[model samples]
Target: MSANHPELLKLSSPIRCKILERVNKFKAKIEFDGRIEYAHINNTGRLREHLIRGKTGFCLRFEKPKKTKYRLFSIEVDGYGALIDTWIQGKAFERSLDLKLIPWLKGYRIIKRNVRLNKSIIDYLLRRGDEETYLELKSAVQRIDGYASYPDAPSIRARRQLRDLIRYVEDGGRATIVFMIGLRDVIGFRPNKDVDLEIHKLLLRGSQIGLEIRAIGVYYDLHRSSIRLWNPDVKTLI
Candidate 1:
């Protein structure tokens, strides 16, 4: 397991709030300082287990006006905090790469972000000498009965990305699918077969063909209002 990055530990503290109601999958009403406001939920997962009434969570206020006044980024679940922001996953992965926390990608340099390849725009394209690696980051927020699962909702796009990665591997190129588990204290990682069976199978086949599949656990520090790497060696159930 890798140590936490020092720079990431310096983020400003978050505002403590109580979840009043879930307006929908992407918005929620929260209470802080006796004032109620609707905040944009940064995660797309069906977080029925976490964002419930009376649950304490953290919200980051925006300095400028936008679609929503605030963003709910983390929620307390069973005494542990989960980082629900999808954006944080990408940032954390970049930091991890910079720190050489991922051993396999140690010497690789990020050549581009959102690199267009075939029918998909991958999250990153890394290069080292003559080798090029394509990487995609998927935020995993749904945890059930001690297991963390990806794509809380069915996504054809997720499957498409997997196919692209598989093709890249077939062409003698390297490809990686990273599942950044946004929650802490998960026993293992797996594809949500009940929600997306095809993705689950693709992951299995991708692993068989040298497509690197990794699951890293990430959690929000309530005291720091920052996301940190929780587990570097999170088990992959698949």
Candidate 2:
């Protein structure tokens, strides 16, 4: 990895597989080693554009046996990998924070995870001196023509979370929303206006307020079973 791109912890060596079909938003049937097995899909987006029937991808087997034996981790799109697991976004961002790889949020230390305030559960709570910062993480998997977009489907929960972040800012605390783009080739990110107009408008309003909005691009290499930061300075395309 270069100075600008930091490597994330590899969970497990990925197994080469092909997606047979999407069982639902949270599950899929995949073929690996000439056997068809049902696996868990962590991403909730309507990934119709990426999760095609015969598309090659990578999956990780469970360390211990569970309801699902495998989890679809990443899929190759146009020779570039797109991470499909939403759970990895927070882990990657937290690792970056610990290593001080993020420039703007370098000195802050994470005090808590899954912090609850009012009705929403923010992703992290950080403190630097007497000031506190509440942070939320959103995983972006939908990409179009080198641009990444969030919320492939309508998200009322996302809207509520934004409202709570705005309130936190209004009450004299710092708040930030980080969009983690999972597509390797994305140059920038923006809210999906066609899918969720309310979220698009809310993101604009939140940016106008004191809520800090940031984005970073990530790349997952199935051949190496590794993840790394692709773009350190992701632009806000709003």
Candidate 3:
């Protein structure tokens, strides 16, 4: 990790807003600048901690025409901000990779983005020498008991991808599953068994079957108003 470029990504036209209520899985009502409006929620996870009423949220104001004028990116967590936007999390991960911040993937280069394998579209494909690895990134914004957790709700898609990765590893192929821990104060990352026991079981099975499991932390610093790469190699609890 380079000392000069610590902040991985900066928010675009960010504004502080108060979360009113989550209208649905895709939309949330927020109050900002003395006005109430709907903001697009990019994450599908059940963010029970961040989406509370009156909780402060950081959002981006989009100039282009869209369904919602604002998009919720991060929410206040113990005076700091916890990034909740899935898109922003992916962007931060890409920036970290480009800067060679992730130590585990030091010699690897991204060959493709959103590559299709079998029936699922994995996040990235990397090559280092003759070895090729299919990598999938999962957002772990749910913070529980000083650890970053995944799938605040049950996700069939995530479960299917886990199965596919496990099978791919079994068939003499290389695969890696990375959990993007989007919090500043997490000790480590782990699968949320309480939310989805099957996912937890599948992750355990995948790790046991030679699937490379890794974790990286990317979080938003409210005081700096920029997204920072908290840790390039966060410990994997599972």
Candidate 4:
């Protein structure tokens, strides 16, 4: 199958590496050029499946290193590279917006980014012809049963954000929660209820009310050597 949308971002000076071990939630050890090197992990999710020992990974040299010299952004998964960096996923989402690749979000313009909503910050504040929307983005790299799942580990912060969105919707405000599936192949997106039952229940309640829940898939295409928008409207299997 061909890509549904154009390349969103290219791997900037990506270096081939192998996952040696996970140092922590924010760091990992990789072997580059047959030398052990430390890589910074951007996502906070438990990436035990992706960061396994001897798994092939791709890293970009840090412009300024504080603790590590490289940032591990993608890992080889079933011959394709799964983009695991949340920041890069955000960039891909923004690029998709700029290109109008998301049909449902067409005509919406970003009025502000990182909008403060109560105690939490939404990813984007959008305006389209007198209507405003609060949008939040979550990255899903955990693959389960041919679907992209989220929150490989429990996240109190994520639960709080969902609650805030629910409240905003209850107050007659427009809100949307978008899951950025960072995998190349998936049947659709689903909340990992087993991992976080509260998130699953909250999503159900939010959908029952007036919250717009959507998903998009973006991943690093190993054959193309660049990140491509795989699916702009991946079905939300809620």
Q: Write the per-residue lDDT of candidate 4 for residues 65-133, one digit (tens) a residue.
A: 899999999999877889999999999999999999999999998999998998898899999999999
Please write out the lDDT profile of model 1 over residues 1-238, one tens digit for every residue: 2235333433455788999988987899999998989899877777777788999988777888487788898888765568777776778878878887777687998999999878998999999999889999888888867888887888888899999999989989899888999887789898888989999999999999999998888787665556677766588877
How high a TM-score does candidate 3 get? 0.95
On TM-score, the candidate that comes out on top is: 4
| Candidate 4: Cα lDDT at 226 | 83
* TM, every model: 0.92, 0.95, 0.95, 0.97
Ranking by TM-score: 4, 3, 2, 1
Off by over 4 Å in 1: 1-9
Candidate 3 deviation (Cα RMSD): 2.0
- As for lDDT, the candidate ahead, 2 or 4, is 4
- Local accuracy of candidate 3 as per-residue lDDT tens digits, 77-138: 87777889989888998889889889889889889999988878899999999999999999
Candidate 2 on 1-238: residue-level lDDT in tens?
Answer: 4234568857576788898899988898999888999888888888887789999988888888587899887888766578878788778888888888888886899999999978899999998888789999888888766788888999888899999998888888799998888887667898889999998888888888878988988868655667888775699877
Candidate with more favorable, higher TM-score: 1 or 2: 2
Which parts of model 3 are misplaced by more than 4 Å? 1-5
The list of candidate 4 runs beyond 4 A from truth reads 1-5
Clashes of 4: 0
| Pairs with steric clashes in candidate 2 | none
**lDDT of model 1 at position 231:** 69
Measured by TM-score, how close is model 1 to the native structure? 0.92
Evaluated against the true structure, the overall lDDT of model 1 is 0.82
